[model samples]
Target chain A: MRILLTSVFVDDQAKALHFYTEVLGFVKKHDVPVGEKDRWLTVVSPEEPGGTELLLEPLGHPAARTYRDALVEDGIPLAQFTVDDVWAEYERLRGLGVRFTQEPLEAGPVTTAVLDDTCGNLIQIATQPE
Target chain B: MADDLFKALADPTRRTIIDELAEQSGQTLFEICSRLSMKHRLGISRQAVSQHLAVLEAAGLVETRREGRYKFHDLNTAPLRLIVERWLVPRTSEPEENTP
Candidate 1:
């Protein structure tokens, strides 16, 4: 089976859309009304429009808050996206006032950095050996 | 306290953790684990790393800081002064009888 979609629980879908598109440079792929207060929102990389979709799920469940909070407290990222150069992306994002929990660090074959998504999640950007 | 410090420094894994922390003062547990497993080639579990951090924290060799929703671990070499005070400093301050 192909993995076409993944999700990160965001505290606010509107804010997530702005950060994912305007700041982090992801393109909006889907946006439909899910319920009274939620939307079926997703974003895809501009480079690979059809590659995969990241669902900006709402933090509707009570357990989700606890789960994400625990992970965030320890600086664990819920989602990771591959980049051309992590250091460059890190610098670019920092210029936009993005708060990084972990700066660009070269660990063995991979280099990564973690930034707060501002929607109650930490996202990781990495450059892995291909 | 001295016993705790020595015991914390006794483990190879713990020492490696200190070495990584020394390289970067403020690091998350996730970052520390990444360094140990990726950079150091250490085959260790995240829970084990957490326990190791606890030991270091008790020894006063590591300190944890809370900033907003995140918690970061920082290396503090202050407790290491005990080693110098207990042995190295005393020897240097002592009058050498052989010099007389």
Candidate 2:
């Protein structure tokens, strides 16, 4: 079996769609209305449009909210995404008014940076070691 | 399955437990608790570890068997492999040589 989808709980689906697609450069892959206010929304990396999808699931469950808040409070990233260049990505994201909890740092062979997704999640962007 | 797996992995403690099981599978609850405390310095109770294992088992990331009086847990990495093959492997392969 293959992983068709994974999800990151978001506070608002519409806000998440805007930030993930418009700012983060992912393409909207699916958006089907699921409930009265929430939809089965998902996005894919621009570079791999047909690849695995990241579902922007609603944070309506009480457990989800608690889990997300605890991670954010502890300064831990909820999810990590690989980038071609962490520094360049950091600069580009900062230019777009994105708030970063940690700036780009080279540790060992890889470089990484963490930024708030503005949807109750801290997402990490990293570059694989050469 | 995806939701359950992700939720299981969401907690750092559960992740660490999985890491331990990955390093050496077929460990009993007592062994797991001891390893967590000795190696990871996590002083979580045996009851707590059992609950975490239950979550992991429900996620299809862990399998358990009862042998006599001992219940042994083993890591089922199939789910994680599916994730890596689906998204990570493809994205990391043949990246543009120079893109800024």
Lowest lDDT block of 10, candidate 2 chain A: A101-110
The list of candidate 2 runs beyond 4 A from truth reads B1-100
Name the lDDT of candidate 2: 0.80
The true-versus-predicted C-alpha distance at residue A69 of model 1, in Å, is 0.7
**Once superposed on the true structure, which residue ranges of model 1 sit more than 4 Å away at CA?**
B91-100
Q: Could you tell me the TM-score of chain B in model 2?
A: 0.82
Per-residue CA lDDT of model 2 for A1-130, tens digit only, reads: 9989999999989999999999999999999998688899999998998899999999889999888776565345778899999999999999999977656655456676778888888887888767
Candidate 2 residue pairs that clash: none
Give a tens-digit lDDT track for model 2, residues B1-100.
7778779999999999898778777765655665677567787987798799899999899998754323568899998865676567767565442212
Under the 3 Å rule for N, CA and C atoms, how many clashes does model 2 have? 0
Residue B1: error of model 1 in Å?
0.9
